[model samples]
Target: MLTATKMFMIVFTLLSIIKSVTLSACDEQEILDISDGELLPNGDVVFDGVVYENRDYFINNVTGIKTACPKLVINKCCPFGTGYKTRQCVNITDSFDAPVWDRYKLIEGARAREMFRFRIGKINCTRPYARVLVSQIGQLDWSDNWHLKSDGKLFVELDSSIPPWTVQPPDKYCIDTFVYEDQDGKTHTRLDALACFLDETPPNHFEVRSTCMLLSCAFILITVAVYAWLPELRNMHGRVLMAYLLCLFVGFILMASMQIMLTIDNITPHICVVLTIVIYFALESAFFWLNVMSFDIWWTFSGKGGMTSKKMSKRFCAYSLYAFGVPTILTIILTSLEFSGLPPHPLLPMVRYQGCFLFGRSKLLYLYGPMFFLCLANIVFFIMTALRIARIKHETEMLKSKESAMHDQHRKDKQRLLLYLKLFTVMGINWILEVISALYPDADYIWCFTDVYNVLIGVTIFIIFVCKRKIFRLIKKRIKENFTNSKNNSEELKYKRTIPTRLCEDSQHQRGSVETIRTTIGMENGVTAEANTTIL
Candidate 1:
């Protein structure tokens, strides 16, 4: 009995020794050493991870525990506490012993509660113009918002969608995606709004401008539809109007889309570049088309009814190329300068690094300069057109005693001339305002007027060209035909109803009396002084 008891004691002692050695080996593999690490420009570090070379024990992003922590720690040794682990948001320049990095930095006290989760702590960087990021478990998560705290206050939300967010030397702001509750939500005192305003700058004016551009887009679309829907209205005048509206339609669309896209988080530079080029081409084409209209009108009024239909067609084709081609070439040159960064002129204030900005004096020199010349040239054309109409009027007055076909044709020409004038005035005035405003950047009142005018360009066009008697007549004519067709269908349905189910069964058999049935159906469908009785 004594020998058996001694053997049992010896085996239990051996088991205890094996268990202690196994746990010690696991502990040796879990922790990593952070000494002699090098810092990167973007808040990343390069370390051998020699302290806990075995990755099974160290988790990334510091979000949670590894598979070995809970099963082996005996007393929940993860995070090691106080003297064990040091984790915080630190600046590259900050020393390991910096008190600010630890004071403002976060420690997840709640991490002790959840065995599988680490309470992510937040930190405030002290470095000026530093490249910062929101890392998820030591990995870059660009989508995460950098909730910056300045003196423990909420700063302006910086976007990760843009290129690296950095404040200019004089200004201070962080690029962050979301607003943090812990930080009071206030836009940083020195936020340079222009940094994030690449697609549409002057953030305060964005809503007003976008509203106007979107409305203009809607109006231009309607005008284009009017020209397309009625083939009969595809005459020379109508075709020119359609072309003008189409250009305006495209330009307004780009303006509206850009305004909204600038607010988005992740917009590419190439997309902005394309939008800028297209908008320039479209607006230029619109301006030239306006010039073409004025010239066409002058030609018509100046002729003694010598403008033949074939000649009109030829002129339209030639003018279209002139109008579209000029803008195309100008756009190509401007685009090359923009893409290659070889511009001869100084870049716009906000456009130095911002993609696709065009609201500067330099862009006006290349792009808007041609438009200004077109506007000036068209003004002379308008004057010539007016003089021709006056001469025609004088001739009509001299022949006032006689009403000849020539006089009637002159009267029609006068009406057309006036229509073109109204169209020109409506379209040209807004552009004029734009130019004047550009010249006098300090002119607040002029800009306000221009803002309202540019948006209402489409409405003005609709009233001048689309609300006319001829266009209205076409609309009413289509509506009338549709009404008649629908009325006939309803009458047939009524007749069918009147003919009982028994008669409907014999409808095929009544083919011999088709005419009589038609007359009966019409009588039943038509309303009169008294209700008509149909005998079928």
Candidate 2:
């Protein structure tokens, strides 16, 4: 009896040792040195030839057991702390690959819980019951709001309005599809058609948005052209206006092109990223230029000495430095954060990670934040200039409209201030609408109204600046000059054709001498110095 008992003890000890070795071998081979690993469908993570059962399992077990902690990380990890990574919105033809679906089958039964809050992407669901059909996890109603329980289970309340297809709710979390094999080795499948992979926006939505943006871009180009073509408009003020409009034009065109490409399924991820940076830079530069205009107006009315042509040129160079330099720095910062591999945060402009453009908090903080401050500054400048103008008026009441040269300049400056005010108001309204739309995305009517207003922005600007009486007179003047020059050319050709070569040459010499004599006399009479102060 004693011998038999001793033999049993030895066998039991051997079995325990073998079991520990077997478990340790699996751990050593498959659970060590996992960094930046990707989560698999079967509640496992695989990277660098190593695997862990789930994100939690990797985190919990890899401590002290491996030199490095096992981590499940993915790129574009925006909408952080939401327990998911958001991908760029894609079109119908850009759905998950067949291989992805094949691996998706592994997420059955308890494995579903591993992907509890995995986000695929946002969808523009047209169907009334689209959300209900897309979600299968816990038979929960589709909601942006998510809840996590202490036991690591995800729970969502059901909406009674959504009719239930199954009598019993699902015990596990799964979306789009659920596949499993029973003890009998029979595969059971439950599939729901999620419209997420379909066209994200309505077909007409892109067309309308793109058309409005393109229209705006065309008007912006026209505005720039007007400034470029007219010497009167090519002064310090005109240069600033042209620069601002050109930046606005670039932003609008690039944005419209990106949307059109998305609609046609022609844009690649890389191109989307590049266009996003360019658009951001252009838009920011435009705002800076607008700010420069406000500052210049304030400075003009600040009782400073009048500017000469050389001084005006130097000041314009300074304005260009501020307007262009700041946006370049901002763009560099945005690009650096994108490529720096830094952990996701609310402050960073994760342009590449989130989507093609700024969204959510990033949009508000980066795009609107600077604009809000600049607009505020513009208002302050306008107020200060108005106060200074009032003071000047009080002092010059006796000389009201008496000094033609000084009064004319003051009138021109006042006109410029009014023009700036109109432009500021228009842009300010646009910014406000953008903020509202972003904050309350479900307000479809607001989106529609914003789109209509976008089209009217360019129209309104054209009316405010280009459609003025003064602008019309300038246009007429330019046309008359061109016509007169053409007529003179024709007259000269006729004179040359009718006359002999020798006689024509002699007449040309005499005419040149006579013109020089007349120009000399004119200079002698009209040599008065006129103040050429440029109102930027």
Per-candidate TM equals 0.53, 0.61
Error of 1 at 116 (Å): 60
Query: Which pairs of residues collide in candidate 2?
Result: none
Candidate 1 lDDT over residue span 1-536, tens digit each: 56988988787566545544544566656543333444345433334311122322332224433223322111111111211112222222211110111112333442212222121222223433232332321234323322222222212224433322322211222221221222465422111111112223223465677788888788878888887888777777778878988998888888777766766433566666678778889988988998888888777777746657897788789989998999999888777666574533354322334344465475667657887788788889889988877776777665464567777766766776677778778876876787687688656778678768876788887777689898899988878887999999999999888789768668856764775556666667784323332332
Judging by lDDT against the true structure, name the best candidate.
2
Candidate 2 Cα misplacement greater than 4 A, ranges: 1-204, 497-536
Clash statistics: count for each candidate: 8, 0
The 0-to-1 C-alpha lDDT of every candidate, in the order given, reads 0.57, 0.65
Per-residue error (Å), model 2, residue 125: 12
Q: Per-residue CA lDDT of candidate 2, range 228-308, in tens?
A: 877888888899988898898889899889878877767666777799889999999999999999999999988688789
The total number of steric clashes, by the backbone 3 Å criterion, in model 2 comes to 0
Q: Using alpha carbons, what is the TM-score of model 2?
A: 0.61
